[model samples]
Target: MKTYNLAFKYRIYPNETQANIINVTFGCTRLVYNRFLAQRKELYETDKKSVTYNTQAKELPLLKLELPFLKEVDSIALQQSLKNLETAYKNFFQKRTAFPKFKSKRSTRKSYNTVSTSNNIRVEGNFLKLPKLGLVKIKLHRAIPQNYVIKSATISQEPNGAYYVSLLTEFQRDIKEVPSDNNIVGLDFAMSELFVSSDNQRADYPRFFRKLEAKLVKAQRELSRKVKFSQNWYKVKLKVAKIHNLIKNSRKDFLHKLSHELVTKYNAIILEDLNMKAMSGVLNFGKSVSDNGWGMFTTMLQYKSMLLGKQVIKIDKWFPSSKTCSSCGNIKDSLSLGERVYNCECGHTMDRDLNASINIREVGRSLLAY
Candidate 1:
């Protein structure tokens, strides 16, 4: 099977012309998204929502027809914006969810007008070729395959004033026989540590946020001293963003490595399908929650399991595994986060995470066997 994959962290340097193209497409995409979101909000608030795609297509030409300049940017982005509105509405109404909120004007709310599929783009020895952008002078630190059907390429600017192109690709792999029944492990997630496994192995959080907390606060204080929208203020803003980005990158590296090891070493892995969105509401990690990388870890583990042909069993969130005693088949009445050790009145004693992990693995194995 040809599966889509992404090659990230590729350095890019777009000349003046390319930069103009990127900016134009990005502005066009943002405008369309904001307009579509406004339309949806008005539809939900009032009753008249006759804005169908066919009508949009017919009406959209009139929008750019007089100006004609807006059409210079990629038309594909406008279509996708309309498609997103349709799909989002369908999902919300079918599931009976609240009307989708309008897109925020905050910078983070914007999506880039990147290529639909980055795999269609390619990097030759000295030059990178994009479908629309053509061959610009590309620097290759490593050799990438010259021939592959390009899908889409998203070129983005980072807070550190560096540019990057994320090319999504597809490739055929020679399937290897999955080594079944190799090793089964269960893992427990926590706040202080990244995870503790059933085999008594533990991976602690790198604590990047904790380490930089003092420095980040100092930077914010300095930033506050600057006048709003001034050059110094913008510089301070970049400083804050850079530090946050550092924390994010560190956490991602740790999570990716940990997930890779777990998936490779164990044939069957058991973990809770943690409701991170819900958990975030209850936990006070400040901005660190976004940088904690728990959600990213689980997402990586899930996909790695599928890609490697391993079994990843998501135990129910309310399965009582944490409060259950693995030694004597006893379930405790209550358990708190402070309890590092589990002591059962039935003469069962074990570490809290260890016991929980054992229960998870046992329950998962039983489920798989059945």
Candidate 2:
């Protein structure tokens, strides 16, 4: 049995008092993280020294003595914030991400992470027990496995004032690999339809953001006309946030359902490993690329396939899947983006994405033979 971690998120309804406490915790965690990050930067610049999580964590007690309000919130959340800073620094040094930036007070999303200790975090019917805030009402939409053990919980408040808790749990399971060359399919990324499958099926993605763009623009126009920080302005801001949330939720739901369908139908799924960031920024296809949620779909396919003992294969990004003929394997000198239909001198003509998907599947099959 191998151990795995999974996160289950649930909507939480806290009393006014508990809500205040949660908000306070978020502020305290952010404050601690920013404080330590600034200190680390100053120390490294002045004395050529670095601060570790342990060094900063040991000072929390002294900080509480100086700022006393820090003692009112969960202590573990503060430590977790420091740990997050450490992680950020590690990622920066490893060239995996840019340097960490200071947390802004006006940020829309507010969150803090807390660990479970001594049964401090648990679910009881319709309530969840959390650190410092006890027995907040939770909407348990799905049942958790009996063997899963709660590890940590992340509490977050969305822009629309909805509170959610994502519980990280650990469990063990045995997964055996299922190898099959017959049940395989390839997918080519599509800007408008999401993807084209080897079997000539399109995802037929409904561009959620595009559909709601006009509504969002009108809402923002009204928000702009209102006085900033006024009651009316706040109300309009909430309306705008709700619209954005609707788009995000709709897109996520579609991707989840489509990924589930693909995983269920294929044993081995192949795709081209396209750099979505480059495609969005360098290629100037930001809006269309972001609306499709291709990156999220690929991630879902990978994890779901692994759990089901299936496969997800990605060919090289530089492969000339589009410029090469799928029938005769003739490589063309060049193929323009406007050419939606692929044509070769060998008398093969097909839709461009379908041809690319076929090439991806053949390449994946060859790789599997090795």
Candidate 3:
């Protein structure tokens, strides 16, 4: 049996009362998380003792007695908050992330988690039954798979004040077999184009941010003119946040569609392992580099490929892909970014990005052969 993890996200509509309850839950969860974080920090500083999940969880009942508002929210949500903090600590010890920090009430992104136990969570018709908030209207965009077991749900409020829930589920399914005689392609990421494929296909960059820069600048300026913490300021802040959200959603949609198309057509995909951090540090190109989201695109490709039983290869960052002649295998002595066309001494010439993609394909084939 092959076990897999799946997440189903959906938009939710909460009434005024439910929304208020959600807000209170968010605040209470934040308070509990910060309190425990402070406790752990003090413990570590004073006696070099590390605080674990069990130790903190044991104190929750006592905490609720003192802070009665915490008891009003779902107990599971409070426990889950502590669990999140513990997970953050684990990540820090493993060097996967920095140390955990206290959550802020003023943060636009607020969320809490709750596990589904004994049918506490369910979807009926067009509503989702959560622990504290009962039967909220939900836009069930897609049906949940029959085999999947709902484990937990993360309720979050976005910057634009839209509410969403991501249901984490688990199931077992057989992995798709990778066909032996399958089409392979290489991808070259560029600023002008999102990607160029070895088969001469080009996906033009959608420049979503550039298109909205003018509107964003105007909105931000208007926001700056408002008095801090005033009603006008709050309204403008939401407007600016909505515009930013639009840009982010558009970019994410485009990337997901492109990655899905590639994974669908090719049995194997190859790409250069670019140092995105170093690329972003370059003076003039930093904004473009960050806006392209190369890292996020690659990550999506990798996970999607894994789910579909497709192969993805990453070549060394130092590989002279643009400098090497795809036809003759001769490495050029000098190549500049300004040279959009690759010219090799062996009388071979082609579009630079296309040529590099072909070289990446060749490298991937060689690696697979071994």
Candidate 4:
């Protein structure tokens, strides 16, 4: 049996009162996280020891007494904030991520997470019953698996005042396996296009930011002209945030659809292990590379392939896919970045990205054969 953890997110329409409560919960969670982070840092610096989660949790009641506003939100949400901080510290020590940083109220996104209890959390007709905030209208775009266990929910508020809840659940199930056959392709990342596959298929890159560049510039200029923190400034800020969120949403949607298609159609999918951070340092390509969202696309491909029991092979980053001739296997000593076509001494030639993709496919096949 295979065990899977999944999260399903849906848009929520909370009434004004409920929205206020959710915003307050966000503030309380942020306060709890920041306070504990400060405490841990100070204790470690001064005494060469750190405050653990339980020890700090014990101080929550005292702090709440001193700051009565904290009592207004769900207590469990505040505790979850501490748990998040603990996980962040663990990741840092394990070298998985950078050190945890302080969150800001000026941040465009805010969220609070809370686990489900037998009595406090459940799904009604069209509403989700959260701990403190009662039934809020939800758009059940898709139904959850009946056999899956409901674990926790995270309530998040976007800068445009839109709310969403993500449910994290777990279940045991068999993985869906695809037949191993010729339905395999190696993809090469391209700046002009999203990717070029060994089969000569092209996935076009959508320059989402470029599409909205004019609108963003106008909104930002309007925002800069306003007095900071004024009502008009807040309105302009929201406008800018709305455009940014639209670009993000569109990019994610395209990546999801494309990844799904690749996973469904191919049994073995191979790609080059690209060092995107190093590539971003190259002049004139940083903005285009960031806009392409290659990292997110690869992440989506990985998780989707794993979930469906498909094979995803990543070739070595240092492989000379571009320099070697795909047809004759002749390795050239040098290949310039401006070269659009690859030429070999053996009189074989091909498009640079296509030739790289073909080489990648052959490499993947050789690896799987062993």
Candidate 5:
């Protein structure tokens, strides 16, 4: 059986009173999770072989009853975090790793997670009543699968003072066979262009930050002119936050969609697993910003493949993807990043990136573990 996590974010219309309550709820959940984590640790250290999720969950009903302020927007979520802590301990005991820490309250944004009892977050008309919070008006856009059980629903605040909910769901399914188009592809992620597939397809990288750089600078300037914690400072900070979030959202969306397109259209994708951080270290900081999107691209490709039923074969970082000959398998000693054309003395010539991509694809076909 396979599990798929589907998350959707919808903007919410919340008045000041609702916003205040939401903030408090966020604080309350964080505090509860942290307090429980501390107690769990003490119990385990003081000679108890184990503390299960059941113990942590038993506290929630009483906490809710005592506080009465914590709206059950998500009861399952509170316990699920505790369960996750148990899983962390199991991993630590078996694998000898670091223990999990408490959740932080104020960093960027925090979420209150809830389990969907009906596998659906029913919105009666335009208003939806969450567990502890009364009616919250949200502009519902799309409908999700009701058969799939909702594991968690996370409520977060956008930079523009807008609230949104992300629903995480899972369904049991049989193993799926991905459709093969008899298409083998190689990917060369580079600085100038985003990527060149083994099939010689080039995608343009949309540099979002470059487009909004001026606006961000202006927002920062406005923020600097205002006193910290003042109304104006908060307003300016929100503007800056909005720009940053937009850039992040845009980049993630682009990568996710591109990965979906490649996995759906082709089979047997091969890519060079370069050390992006190490590569960036050699270049000056500013020079790396416009081009370092390979990490995001590769992550999307790998995780998305699990759902799409495809394989992403990663060639070693040291592999000479550009200098190596696809025809004769002769490895060249050195290749310059600026050189766009790859010419081998063996009389093989191709676009530098395309040549690299072919080498990666051929490697995947011949030596992949399969």
Candidate 6:
């Protein structure tokens, strides 16, 4: 049996008192993170010394004494904030991410993490007990396994003013790898459709953002007309946020369903290792790319495939999948994006995406043979 961690998110409805406490916790966590970050920077620049989580954790009590408001919220959340700052620094040093920035109060998202200890965090009937905020009502749409241990919970408030808690749970399960057979498929990323599969299947993803673009624009225009920071302004702002939330939820729902179908149907899924960020910026395809949610779809496929003992293979991004003729294996000098149909001198013709998917499948098959 191998240990695995999974996060199950549920909508939570907290009483007014609990909601106020949660908001306080969010602010306190943000404050602690920013304060420690500034201190670390100043200390490093003046004394050529680095600060670690332990050093910051040690000073947390002193900070609470100075600003007693911090003591009113969950202590674990504060420690987690420090740990997050440490991780940010580590990631920056490793060249995995940019340097951490101070948290801004103006940011629409607010969240904090708390670890579970002594059964402090748990689900009872329709209520979830969180640290310092006991028994907030939860949706409980799905039941967690009895054996799975709750490790931590991340409480977040969205721009739409909805509360959610993501419970991180650890469990042990045996994953028997399925033998690779002929049940393999390749996918070529599509801007309009989500993907084109090797078997000529199209995801036909409904462009959620594009469809809702006009409504979002109208809402934003109305919001801009409102007096800034007034009650009406805030109400209009919530309306705008709700529209964005709708788009996001719709896109995620479609991607999840499609990924589930793909994972269940295929033993091995192949794709191109695409640089989506570069693609978005370089070609000025930001709107189209973002609407498709290709990156999110691949992430879902990866974890779902892993859990099911299936496999996802990514070929090199620079591979000439689009340029090469699938029928004769002839490589072309260049291919233009305008040409939706692929043509070769050898009298072979095929749809560009379909041809690419075929090449991707062949490459993946060859890789598996080794």
lDDT of prediction 5 = 0.74
lDDT of 6: 0.94
Candidate 6 to truth, TM? 0.98
RMSD, every candidate, angstroms? 3.3, 1.2, 1.6, 1.7, 3.9, 1.1
- In the range 51-93, model 1's lDDT, one tens digit per residue, is 7766666666776876587688766666766676777777887
Tally clashes: model 6: 0
lDDT per residue for candidate 4 within 22-98, as digits (tens), equals 98888889999999999899889999997788998999999999999999899999999999999999999999999
Which candidate model has the greater lDDT, 1 or 3?
Answer: 3
lDDT of 3 by residue, 131-151 (tens): 989999999989997778999
Error of 2 at 244 (Å): 0.7
lDDT of each: 0.73, 0.94, 0.90, 0.90, 0.74, 0.94
Rate residue 262 of model 6 by lDDT. 97
Worst 10 residues of 1 by lDDT: 104-113
Candidate 3 overall lDDT versus native: 0.90
Model 4 residue-pair collision total? 0
Provide the lowest-lDDT 10-residue window in model 2: 361-370
TM-score of each: 0.86, 0.97, 0.96, 0.95, 0.80, 0.98
* Sliding window of 10 residues with minimal summed lDDT for model 6: 361-370
- TM-score of structure candidate 4: 0.95
